[model samples]
Target: MVKAETVDKAYEIAKERYAEVGVDTEAAMKRLETVPLSLHCWQGDDIHGFLNPEQELTGGIAVTGDYPGVARTPDELTSDLHEALSLIPGKHRVALHMIYAVAKDGKKKDFNDIKPEDFDYWIDWAKKEGIGLDNNGTFFSHPNVKDNMTVASPDKNIRDYWIQHGKLTREVSNYIGEQLGQTCYNNFWVPDGFKDNPIDKLTPRERMLASLDEIEAKDYPEANEQDSFEGKLFGAPGIESFTVGSHEFYQYYAITRQKLWTIDAGHFHPTEDVSDKFASYFPFTKKDLFMHVSRPVRWDSDHTVIVDDALLRITRSLVRDNLLDRTHIGLDFFDATINRVAAWVVGARATQKSLLQAMLAPIDQLKQSEYNADFTTRLIETEELKSMPFGAVWDKFCQDHNVPVGFDWMDNIHQYEKDVQFKRN
Candidate 1:
């Protein structure tokens, strides 16, 4: 166990070190506590919703491991989520896919037929936890995903089905927000694309645009419900030619519609850095943005997040621009190869760590150096800031939040698996 006196002493030392660079370590910790991270629920269940546990993961997405303790029912998933939230620091929201809805009296509701009542349990749970909720419209791993086309399908009925689903999801999001007194971000992501190159690309794009128009036509109070759209570069393997909701498509749509466009960290090319997109897209949109933070290797595989340069760069940009309040950050990775709860803790903590590192940086000094054309000083100070006492501050933050500091959370996770997760057959 970390002693309170030790944590305070370490923080005192870190405060003085950051003070030399004009960074207020105490204020940064308080500001970081206000940042709410939306944790994705699919991680607890390997992206298999309660609607049908046996359904094959389609849309060019796949989960490789069959790790035990995967939540099979809504109750089990909720329990796992509670466990994860306890291990993570700060009060956070949970991001849910529409497919995770719990039907009334065991009666199943199709994606389009789902009502806000179906998510009553989630709203109630969030209320009990004193946290907020966000949601997504599930457009993949379903029978309606014909030829990897939904909302962009040539068939009018198929397009209508997904369009209805999108509208219904917004309604549910509004209801959740109203019940919890917090805005629910309803994000849309479609796996509409082609496996190989297609000559007629414009036709499908036009159809998708029309479908999106219909979906967005539903009027919901902006105070309670916020709408956003996500763009993917391509599918897992087969759908490599083009993804209809490519970054370009959603960027244009979001700009014109004056809505949030979600940037998934792993949705772009492996070599391309999404941190650059903030400066590129935020000007045109001129609206609060959304982000689905994930880690990817060679492909769009939703790997667990770590305290890496990419995450630091993304958060650093947000902090420098003073856009953390306007930006909604959500975790989007799920690694079923390890303990699900542990995966959540690792990703959430890594994200928080990156944000702490960013907040501790001397953005004012760096900007002044740049404005004065002293590029040499800016570069040198930026490089030197990397070795600052960030870990000490982070330890204090965790200690203040009453969460396990350093690897102490591992003991809780092991005990949780033994007491709560492993006995489930």
Candidate 2:
């Protein structure tokens, strides 16, 4: 089942997966002291009940598709997000990311649903209210794709309103920034890549690069603007057929001064090292970073909140490498037709639990320093480098550093154990 109950379900799944059927794992669990599946779980039922106070997450406004039933109009959407943020008193911001469904026709969206006036209105409205937004999946607010209904036949060789959307986005964003009198973060990434026979659809890196160059050339300092890059694991094939870590994205930064990659950890599978595939674990962060942090949703595109163990290791790895600046944790979700606020809460809690797992590291600077150099060398040209097995190498690494608590899940010894058991069972 989709990991609907992130904390509860993940633990249950772990319990089942860890069990050996006839073989014994009770002994193993006893030996390990913990299953180590400590996820960050938060109760998401607080959105409607802000009547009582005192609860909040850290600084980050996750721009998301509207929460169901809760926010419909632009006013409600903006207000709902604000309510979530208010609950977390110490937290100046609560994270958010958008899915197009909020403001568009569900499966068949059109341009009439969105327009420049729509853009002008929201920009002015956000400025007046001092609100900000971010997009993670296909967004109606997106420059080109948002108006998908208008371009009945988008140019295959060229993106539909891609550049136009960029221009509009720039106008709206800058207007908001100037109005809010604060820099608002803009994130870019559509589920734009194909796999296998669909390879020809791979984004022409040069063309995309040129588009980015055009935007950069326009003279709006987008890099200094709060923007990030995010990818989804599942979506309509036209936009979703691509694999997770396409390097074409690298050129995007080559042209612009903006530096941040939105990392949806669950977007990758067990075999891909997201760091290598994208560029480096720290390339985007070298400028600014926005992380779409969550566990890998296996074989499907449901934004379930469970944090994959391997994804956690990636965070620790990033910490080891000093790449936290790019780490604006955006927890995205769209599961069942549940309460809008609860859906947001589910996604938010899952992200938190994943972070808890990420923090498992005991923080050995010496080992991390040594590992960082070696990891980079090996990761030179691989995608999803955070999810590979180099157990022998890691063992030697720990031995060399003389730190006993360091465990790199990149060394897939445990995964191998899990795989072997799956076959046996």
Whole-model lDDT for model 2 versus the true structure? 0.39
Regions more than 4 Å wrong, model 1: none
The digit string of per-residue lDDT tens for model 1 on 359-398 reads: 9988888899899999999999988889998999999999
Instruction: List TM-scores for all candidates, in order.
Output: 0.98, 0.53
Q: Looking at candidate 2, what is the lDDT of residue 274?
A: 60
lDDT of each: 0.89, 0.39
Clashes of 1: 0
Task: State candidate 1's TM-score.
Answer: 0.98
Residue by residue across 1-425, what tens digits does model 2's lDDT show? 11223333444443343232221223322322221111111113222111112222111112224322433234455544443342221122333222222232223333223332334444554455444443222233333432122122135323535555545555544544554555556666543343334544434544555565554456555532455555444333343444332433543552255455566565555466664433354444356556554544453243545545555555555544545444555554444344433344345434433333333232343355457775663344223333322222222222332322122322332343244312332
Error of 2 at 365 (Å): 6.2
Question: Which runs in model 2 stand beyond 4 Å of their true positions?
Answer: 1-70, 86-89, 92-132, 135-160, 191-203, 222-227, 231-235, 239-248, 251-258, 273-285, 307-311, 353-362, 365-425
